[model samples]
Target chain A: MSIPLALASGTGRFYKHSAKIIRFARHGCTNRPFFHIVVMERRKAQHQPVIEQLGTYDPFPNEHEEHLVAFNFERIRYWLGNGAHLSTPVAELLGIAGLLPIHPRTYMTAWRNRRAAEEAAAKASESGADANKAPESKEGGSGTS
Target chain B: MSFGSNLRMFANKASLCCNVNKVTLELFSRCSTVAFLQYDKDPGPSFSNPDVQKLLKSMTRVQLEKVYKKRSVSDNTVEYKFMTSEQLEKQFRKAAERAEKLIQMPPIVKVKEDSQKVISRDPALTNFSNTKFVIADITYGVNSSDRKILVRQTDGTLEYAPLSIRKRINQIYFPHPGRKIRLPRMFEPEHLNRCLANFQYEFILDRACVQFDPYEKEYHEITTKVYNHINESKRFDDLRSTRHFGPMAFYFAWHQIIDDLLYDMIKQDYLKNGAELVALYYQLNGIDYDKSIHEKLETLVQPQSTIQSVLKPKASDDMHEEIKNAIGKSAEDFTADDISFEFIETFVKTKALKKVQLELALQALRETNDEKKKLYHGLKKAHGIS
Candidate 1:
């Protein structure tokens, strides 16, 4: 005798013209992260079975340090044309692919990171000068001596 | 309708009690000074060098049962297989391959900090959305670490998202079990010391490794805190034989506080391991040690580090001596205790350690080695074997 399991799967039932969203379904073991981008009914939970898998997003860096993503642009464009709403993450990906404008937050991060790096560099040089007079201070002035 | 309201009240009461438990289960952390990497200098990158990595892996002393303990398998299906002797051997080989994969500890790199890069400032797109939109490049074939993530702010700035937001985006798509979208209660400043006080070193280290990227600042803070506590308490063996030992040992060595650890290693009769520790110290400080002894250390250390085999091209290159002053800058702090004059002619006779730097390294190895040798022979002699 066989019993049906309740694991998340596509039910193979959907209204033909219903709204959908392309997004990720989490997969992989604890501490090991992987994702499958799928087109599913807009109202369903993320783990719900989807109409089709469009791509995968692997957040862990490969040895080459690339966050690999695999998606069918044709299928993605088709879904978009058919009035499927794009999730923020999906929109971000498309932006990176030259399909849309670069996300504004990416610009913000680049600037923030740039500022942090500059501040660190400046601190390093100042600390180098401080090192010149450190021997006199002798193990730093700490505690009420 | 009354029954529904009653259920809602019960739920509300249950949630309130849970919040109370959370609030009372934790307290604020003391702003205890960090001992490891306290000088605004990185203590971990020292481990990236092959030699310290080798020593760390050896010190960790991997025991398969502890490292590869069974997980709660989600799959309930069970299949039985009949196999010939040869087939069973192949199965064992496959299992061993998986074991090798399990012990690969996370790498320690300086947190990746980059300068601000402005892509564009389109005020026209201002007020496009009140909420921020995080965009991740899902281009197939890019490594996750290198994959660029961008975000759009409410003020019409389309630039790179900060590391915090990027980590959130990563977790949204690829969630790690037990990792929360927001900071876990244990990681809050008030709760951190409470967890550390329980000496939950292994659990804290393991969770942090999974929850944060190795290069993230939070990861370093948590790891360094644990290492410092272990050092302060003289409980150096707490992280031993686990993946945590790699970074912890490197932290001690880089910070030049290996005196206590060296004493322990020597006293434990892990002389070869002690020698490797010395080698690590010398390498970090550019101490001119005997090259042949270095080779001996290489032979002594079994290559159990499956993760580092590829990252170790700088075996003999100590060209970074200028910045390596942090190591070995302080005088030896541990005493040369219980090592009889007898060792000067035998173990320390190898001249493997420099007289100036090593009065500390050779402190207790000979005594322990003799003790173990005598014990081994006594067992043999009791059976009438010469």
Candidate 2:
């Protein structure tokens, strides 16, 4: 008989169709933890778990960094696909990790940077055009003479 | 004139200053004791008569000098600065020019009319009441003919107007029409309230933490204690009764955390939904609740132990080092946004998270990058960016 299994903080629930594993990664600052949950296969080991990453779970850590923890991502996705239910928080974490395939035009730091660069380039070209125009106007007058 | 006549004229002038009251003169004559009083060895005799004492008191050295100076000045020839005839004529001409300018100006006629008159004349003037229209200073004349009132405003501008009897009555009786006026709002109160609730909900969801208080009479308390015991061996401070460690403090701590969360949210999206929350909270609960209770709630719920541990310089040093390694730069090199600055200040001051100072510094560097990008875009727009 298959037994019910929940990983990480028990935020995952198992349903008849699939089991969802909420995986989180504590990656940012030492005491500041950021979590992401990923659904993976329950049969696999913790590190080499074969499944798609589902989501993240991050509990803000204390100063000593003793309680910092992270969850396996690949196994979480595998479980989610098979039939695993996620809680609200787990679902949100997964959405942020891009495992759920959200809106393509989501606001991201990289997009902002790209737009800023394009604007900067446009400004430089406009000024360049202005500078060139002044010289060209003077040349036109000289040619007329 | 004879020398005796001239001496008599001088004596008459001198006597004018020393003349006593007629009654006193008569009393002096009747009283042969006046000589004894005058020659009395004691000055006390003069004090017996209040009039004599008053005269003697008034004749001080300063008073005498003032009198002599007044006489001397009156007797001397006085000099005056007299203007020449041409100078007088020029001054008179300027005065005449100014007077002519003043006379040429029209008289101020206060239009003691009601709002009805003004409304009938100009519908736009209905915006105001108790209208006392001042006929312009250059108005040559004012007359009402065929229900039309003619007015010449200052600067030689003439206006043909109609009488507004309704406005005139309004001005004379009910001058204030504030009861009928209605104003438009940019955002409805209900809409604003909903927006605030949404922001508050998101903020709470993002930052709210559930911790097991050892003092709580629940199984969670025992589990938390066991967890703490297994995690570390440091002596924990018993903050059961402390004002900064209890439920109230926890509430306030959570409030501050949520405030920071909202700040981060707005920075990411530029939607001041948090401001709407604050406004709605005030509107529903009043300023007292927002300023006192809400503010206190944030302080009460804060995790003082974690803050205290983080703020400790020795404890924070290692954390700072780790942060530096992660970011690959010094925290001092970072520049933060206004919201981040406020968050850092509040978090450090209340929670005493000394390590956060380094985090703030790193965040500041990222903020600088953001600002530079924003500035570059702004400049590009000014240059007509495509």
Candidate 3:
């Protein structure tokens, strides 16, 4: 077997006091959901004691047809200035929040959804056109054409 | 003999209420909770008038004992004081002032307008995200209410965040105790009715005031439903002397359903508060009342006597004797206040929806007052109070 690129020393490879990361901690009940935006040690599992809570996010839409997210950007800037990394979901959220550049995954998902919707529309129109032609022929209006 | 008959009537009424409660409980979740007290003309300007403010304040009938009741302190800053008489008096005055601020009523007004107005649009920004982004400004020194919450939509329109989203974001940044991002399950109609049936009006209204702003539809829906239950159960006493009493009074006056509340007031010998209730109805509806009648009710309050003072000379720890003294004192106090009786009589004649019901209750009150007065006089004669 090919050797792994990195050494297998657990303590050396992953330092005890690794870089800090901004991430989500799962909250809320089944079927219902919520998240807390937290700053924590990079090697720490979720729900472990965190460095700080930067914000919260509600994935579901409210009565206003909007996803609600709250970020203490002042703290966010402080953590980032001190070199805290961001998880992919946090990065995506901040991208839409207009704090960071838009994430590439967001664009990719949007494109895929759009493509699927357009394909559905095209198929519907093609079938609709065939139905129209058949009905016209059965109605005996061929002379007018 | 009259007291025995009264107890029987009370029992029948209690059973009637239980039957109604059973029916309501058996019913499944009804359609959407309908909003109540939707004034076409904005109640805002009217509520701001000083007269209206005074009426609401007096109607609240704050009891210092309840307001300053000891509860667990949320923080570790609890203080104990040992002060001289003067210092203690000063401290109490300061506490009363703080209590005034705490019980200040939330504004009653028309529904709030939509805040999610489009600001700008960019087709290029479309397709980058599938839902609106809610961004809050966390800059220090900004008041929570005035903080900027903006939304960038998936379809490339940037707009100000709506009230719901703004409220949520604020609650997250500065979370209120006993409030959550999602409405607590207890507020659902089925559960709320159960709580209401248990006469938990004060708790529900208190939580609602914390959870919702006055002008929101949910706020109106919840409070009005609670008020309806209170009216149905005739449990106005459960809210008395608490901050909710004023708003409940206001709701009754607004909806023209003051007969039950007024009846309760008359039975409890709070005729002055009852007059104030009628006066509030007139004020809210902008009715032109005779000034003389208003002055009459004002003069009536001067002779207001407490049951405690009349019994003070012969005060005993015996519960039965205390109740007898209360009955005698209430009879004397009731007959002495003719001005309030007259004003309330005029209200019953002209305004109350169920006039005969109120009339019979009024007659009953008068008859009971007369009997008690006779009994008290007989007792005095037997003792030979020359």
| Candidate achieving the largest TM-score | 3
- For candidate 2, the per-residue lDDT at B361 reads 49
- Which should have the higher TM-score, number 1 or number 2? 1
Docking class of 2: incorrect
Which residue window of length 10 is worst by lDDT in model 1 chain B?
A: B328-337
Global lDDT of each candidate = 0.58, 0.32, 0.69
Candidate 2: residue A79 lDDT (0-100): 61
Candidate 2, Cα interface RMSD? 37.1
lDDT of 2 by residue, B282-373 (tens): 33222332334223323333222222322334334454454444443332323223333444344344433234543454366456656655
Residue B88 in candidate 1 has what lDDT?
Answer: 64
lDDT of 2 by residue, A60-96 (tens): 4234221122223445544655666564555533333
TM-scores of all candidate predictions against the true structure: 0.55, 0.15, 0.62
Taking the candidates in order, what DockQ does each have? 0.04, 0.00, 0.35
lDDT (10s digit) by residue, model 1, range B1-386: 11122111224444544554432312101112332243234545675767667667777766655665554557646569999967866765665567656667678777766556556676544444334445565444555566666655545566776677667656665566777878777887678898888888888888898778877878877888787787667676777767777777776655545655656666554555565666666676555766465454344344445333323344443423212232211111111122222232243444322343345545444455455455555554554544
lDDT by residue for model 1 over A1-145, one digit each (tens)?
A: 2222232334535688888998887777678868777788898877666777777777675543345555655577877888888788777656654467867664565456545555666666567658785434432322111
Docking class of 3: acceptable
Better of 1 and 2 by lDDT: 1
Best by DockQ: 3
Where is model 3 chain B poorest over a 10-residue stretch in terms of lDDT? Answer: B25-34
User: After superposition, which runs of candidate 2 have C-alpha atoms over 4 Å from their true positions?
Assistant: A1-145, B1-219, B222-337, B346-351, B355-386
- Candidate 3 TM-score on chain B: 0.74
